[model samples]
Target: MNTFSRRRFLQAAGAAGALALGAAACGGDSGSGSGTGGASALTWWDHQLQLQPAKKRIFEKFAKAPGGMPVDYTFNNPEKLGQALQLAKQSNQLPDVHSNAGLQVPAPQLINEGWMAPLELSSEAVANLKDVLLDGIHIFDGKVYSFPIFDYHVYTNVTWFNTKVAEQAGLDPSAPPTTYDTFRAAARAVQSKGGGAAPWTWNIGMTERTADQLNYLAQAAGFEGNTGMLFKNGEFAYHDDAYVDSLDFLLSLKKDKLMMAGSESWVDTDARGRWSAGAACYYFDGPWCPGVVLSAAPQFAESLGVAPILTPSGGAVRTYHGPQSGDYWLTPKSKHAEAANKLLSDYFTTPDYSVEVANTMSQPPRDLDAVEKSTAHAEYKKLIGWFRDTVFLAPTPVVKNVAITKVQVETKPVEPNLGTIIQGAFTGDVPDVKAALKKLSDDSSAERERAIKAAQAKGAEVSLDDYAFPDWKPGADYTLDQYK
Candidate 1:
C-alpha cells in the first residue's frame, strides 16, 4: 500500500478562500391525512420489507387486540422512502407511521419542518429505549422525534472475506489482514490462486454506495473525524490533506489491479451477488451482508469470515459506530397519532416483537437481553460479536454544519457526491484530485453561507458557531455531553 502525508496533501491544494454569506428560506406542508380505509385502519410505510418478510403475524395480533387499529402497511425500498415522503408531505397524505431515512434528510430537519410528529412513549417504553438505543440520536434539540428499532453497533466498513478462498490462496482466515499493506498482500495472494475470480469487488457504479465505502476507507487513511466535507472553526475543510490522501488511496487500489474488473458497473445487489457466487475474494459491507449471502447461496454461508476495516499501521482503529436513527416516527399529518403511537409502543415494547424483528432482519436489537435470548441462526451471533469487538461507541466528533442540512432540504445538489469524483479519478476522468476537492470546498462553503442567511431570515438558530467543534481531538472519545 502507498502512503501520503497530510502536509503534502495540503501543500498540493494551496490556500482556500473565505466563506460567502447568504440567506435562508422556509416552507410549509399544506396537505392533511385521510383516515384509514376501515374504522381503525392505520396506514404504515417502511423499507424493511425490501430485505425481509413483513411481520404479518405480529401485525395480525395487534389488529386482533380489543379496540385494536388494523395496520395497512406499505413496504417500499428505504432508498425511495425519502422521495415518497416528500411527495406525500406535499399533498398532505403522509402515512400514520413512517420510517425516516437519516442520510437523505436529518431527522432534526424533519422535526423543524413539522413533517414528523413528536412521540410520547410511556415511562417503561422510554426506559427500554434509553437502555438499548443511543440517547444522542433520538433526541434532537431537547425533544424526542423518533424511536429507533435497529441499532447498528457496526457501520458499513467491515470486510467480509471468503475463508475458503483465503485457505486456497495460502492465507490464514483466522488472522485476517488489519492493515492496508497486509490486505493488499492477501488480495494479491487470492488473485494468484484465482480460477476466474477477482481479488475484491465493490459497488463502484452506484455513487452513494461508492461514497459510503470510500468514506470508511478515508477514515482508515487518517481522515480523522467526518468522512465527507470536513468542517472546522466554521470553515469547510474540503481540501484537507487527509481528504486528498483518501482519494489517492482509492486510486491506488485501481492502479494495483486489486479491484475486480467491471466494478464500475456493479451496483450493490450485483456486487453482493458476485461476492456470494465466489466470483470475488472480498466484499466490503456491514453485518447485514451475510444475510444476503445466505439468501443467495446457503451452502457458502459457512465459508465467510468477517473482519474490522483495515487501517494504516499505528493509526486509530475507530469505526463509524454512531447511532443511525433508522427509526419509525409518527407523521405530523397522521389522523391517528394516538393509534400509531400505541402500535409502535406495542411492537417495540413487546420482547417477542422486538426479538422477532431483530432475528428476521439479522440485526442487533435495541434490547440487548432480547438479542441474547433470540433463537436466530448462529451466523447472527458472529455478526453481533463483530459489532461488540470493533464498534467505537464514541470517537472524534463530526459536527454537521446546519448549512448542509438546509441545502439538502431546499435543493439536492449533485456536487457533494464524492463517489462520482472518486470514480472519475479511478477512470482518469478527473486528473487532479486537489483541484476537484478545492472546487467542491468552495461550492459547499458558498451553499453553507446561503443556508445560514436563509435560516436566519426565517428565525432559525443556525450559524457558524453551531457547526464548530473546536476542542475535538482526532481519535478522542466524544460522549453526548460534548455534543450538548
Candidate 2:
C-alpha cells in the first residue's frame, strides 16, 4: 500500500540493534557430558527472526570457553519450525529446544497432545516472569506449561503516520487522531489533498490479516477477541454481532476509498516500507513498526507520529503488545533435560544476562532491573507504562494442533488472496455480507474438524469446545464484559 525502503534503517540502526537474545544452547560432538558445571552439548533450534548484528552479538555472548558442555546454536526461517519439528521427530534428532508460535493455531494443539512438556516453575521463577509471561499465558492445570517466550505487543488500528502527509492534508502534524471520527475525517482529508500517496495502509487480505483487522474492530466494539491463534474462551467471541458489525464498519471504510486498494497483501514489513517513504498519511501498526521505520528511514523519523487506535464509539482499546513468543525454554526430550533446565534457569534469572539480552535485542526484558538498562528502555518504559496504564495486555490464545491448523488455512483459501478478501468484502467485491461470512465460518469449521480428526488419529482427545478458545457468543451467557 505504501512504498518505503528498508535500506535506510539498516544503515542507521546499529547492526547490533534489535538483536534477539535466546537461552544458551549446547549441542554437537565437541560438547560432551564431561562438563559438569554447564549443560552438556545441546542443540538449540531457533528461527532467526533478528537482523544480522543481533544474531552475531547473541552468538558471541554464548561463545564462551566451551562452557562445560558446548551448546550448539542454529537459526532458520520461522516457517520452518513445523517442518523441522516433523523431520526431527522422524529422525529422532530434534534439537534440545525450539521456539513455538505461541497462542496461535498449532501451539495449543501441540500442548494438548503432550508434544510439549509443561514448565515446572518455582515461586521465584513465576515472580520473575509476572509481566513478561503474564498470569494467563503460561499456566495449565494451575501449573506452568510453556515458559512465556515473547509477544508482538501493540494496539489495533494504530499506526505510525507521516507528519509531512498530515501537514499537507490540513491535519495537525503534532497531534494524533484520537477518535474514530477524527481518524476517518483525516483519511478523507488526506485523500482530498490528492497526492499520488495513499492515506492508509491495511493488512486485511489473508485470513490471519482479516482476522486481526476484525479482532481490532471487535475490541473497538468493546468486545475482547484475542488476535493470537489461541483466541478462545469467555473474553471474546468470534460469532458475536459486534464481530460482524466491526467487519461491516471496516468494509464501509473500504467502500469510501479511505484505505489503500491492496491493503490485504501487505505484511508488517511492507507496511513499514510504505510509511517510511512518506507514501501514505498513516500506516496501521504496532510500536515495533516505528523502530523498523526509524531503522530503515531515519530521515523520515522526525516526520513520524505515533498514536493509539481510535474507536468509533469514542471508547479506546488499550494497546496489546509483547514479544512474539512470550519467553519459552523447552526441555528437549533429551537425556540432558536436567542440564537444559539448569542453563535455562540461569539464563532467564541472570539479571546481568537479561539486561544484555534486552539491550541487544532492543526489547524490554522480563526482569525489572534488566529492563531499566535497555538502550530503548526509556521508550520501552513508556511502552510498558502504556501497557500497564493505557493498554490491557490480553493473554494471547494457544491453539492445539499447529500442523493441522496450517493445512486448514492453506486448504480453505481466502478469496482473491488475503488482501482481496478484505478489500473485496469492503469494496463490494462480495455484495452479500451474510454469504461471505458463512463461507468463512464453514471453512473455519471444516479446518477445525480436520484438526480434530488428526489429533484423534494421534490418540489425542480434543473436544471442539477446547479448540474454540478466546471466542465467545455475542448475546450468549459468556462475554468479555465479565472480565472488564
Candidate 3:
C-alpha cells in the first residue's frame, strides 16, 4: 500500500509476529455478570475485530435488555484465538461462550472432547432461526450446541472498486469489469489516471486469503467445490485446468505491472487502509469490505462500491458453502448455563439483536429479511442479492455421516497447500505452477485415503463415498433432496 507500509507492515503480520497475541486480546470489563469473582460469569469471546464498536453497543444494550447477563466480553484475532483456545482446552480455562471459528478441528471432535454444552433453546427460539439452520450442521448428537447468528453465504472474490477511482479512470463503478480482460483494462485505466495510488492491490502477503481467492476464482472457472474436492469422483483434484487457469490469471495481473508496487507484501488490513484512502482502485474481498471501510475510513466508505465477482470466463461465480452451522459454542465448564443459553440462543435470535447485527454489516444476520428493513449500507444489501444468486449450499461429509469428522481429524495437512503454492508462484519460488499443483493434488489424495483407513480402523464408519456427491454440478446448488 506504501513504501512505509508495503515494505515495513507485514513482516510482523500474521503468525510469525503473533507471540504476544494473547495480550492483543482486549478483555473488557464484564459490566454485567453473576458477580461472584468470575464464577458463573457469562463470558463471551469473539474473533471479529471490525465490528467491535457495534458489538459493544449491542452488549451495552443487552446488559439493560431482557434476559441479558453480565458478559465478560473478550476479543481475539482468529490466529491468536486458535492458539488461545487450544491452551484453554488443556487448562480447562475455556470461556463459557467462545467460537470455533479458527480451531480447525471438526465439530465432532470439539463435541466429543466436551468443548460444548447444549443451549436447549425453546422451540420458539429455534424456529426463529429455521431459515438458516441445517439438520446436521446446527445439530450434533440430537442436541443443538451452537447455532449461527449470521449467514455464511459469502465469497472472498467480489469485485470491490473505489467508485471515485473508477469514475475518474473512465470506468463505470456501477458496471464493473466482468472478465479478466476488462478487469485488466480497468486497472490500466485507473493507473493511467492515477492520484498517487495504484490501480489495484491485494493482500498477497496473507497466504491463506490469497489461496482462498485462487480457489474461489477456480470455482468461477468451472471447478466444483471451493477446495479441490471434485465430489464427482470423491477425490482431490487440485491440479485441474481451472486451478492453473485461475493461478495463471492472478500471476498475469502481477506480470502486467497493474498492481500497486510493493503491494504484494501487504495483507488485507494493509490494503484496507490503502483502499480507504483511495490509494487502491479495486480489491477482491467479501461482505465485510464495506463495513470495515466505513469503520476504518468513513470518508472513503461512500466511494466503495461492490459488484459480482469477475470470473475468468465472465460466468456466474458460485462459492459453495455447507449448511449454516454454530460458530459460537458454550464450554462444558460454564456455570451460568441458563444465562449463557439466553445470550447464545434467545438473544441471538431476537429481532432486536438480529437488526443490530445486520446493521453492523460484518456478517449478515441469519434473518435476511431483517437486512432489507435494517439501516445497512446499500453495498451490503447488494451483497445479499449476490449471495442469493451465487452462493450455493454444498453437501457436507459430516452432514451425511457425522463420523467423517473423525476422518477429517485424522487427515494431516499436505504442505505447500494451494495457498503456499500460489504464494510461491507470486514470489518466483515455484517455476512450474502446474507441476506444483499436480504434486499437491496427488499428495492430498494419498493423505485423505490414509486418514480414511486409519479412522476406519478406529471404528469410525467413514469412507471415500462419504465425500462423493455425484449429483453435484458446477455452479448449481447441492439441494438436500440430492443428499443421498
Report the number of the highest-lDDT candidate. Answer: 3
Q: Candidate 3 lDDT, tens digit per residue, 416-463?
A: 887778778888999899899899989998998999999999987778
Model 1 regions more than 4 Å off: 1-41, 49-54, 69-72, 84-94, 111-114, 131-143, 229-235, 314-316, 349-354, 357-363, 367-372, 375-386, 393-414, 474-476
What order do candidates take by lDDT, descending?
Answer: 3, 1, 2
**Full-model lDDT for every candidate:** 0.60, 0.48, 0.69
Q: Residue 374 lDDT in model 3?
A: 78
Q: Write the per-residue lDDT of candidate 2 for residues 1-484, one digit (tens) a residue.
A: 1111233222211111000112111001111121112245566665423322343454445545234245666554333344555666677666665554211333334554445555544455544545333222343323444454333333435545787888888888657776667878888989998376788876543234345555665565666444312234422234456556666666666668887767655555455566568777787654445444544455765676766566666653543432334344463366656545555554554555556544543333445355456654233345544444444444322223223323332233333332344556655576765556556555555655675576667655444544343443332333222222
TM-score of each: 0.77, 0.63, 0.86
Alpha-carbon deviation at 450 in model 2, angstroms:
12
lDDT of 1 by residue, 219-312 (tens): 6666644545442454665577767876675567778898888887665666777877888988876556765566556688678787777776
lDDT of 1: 0.60
With candidate 3 superimposed using the best TM-score fit, by how many Å does residue 455's alpha carbon deviate from the native?
1.9
> Evaluated with TM-score, which candidate comes out highest?
3
Q: After superposition, how far is residue 102 of candidate 1 from its true place, in Å?
A: 8.3
Which candidate would rank higher by lDDT, 1 or 3? 3
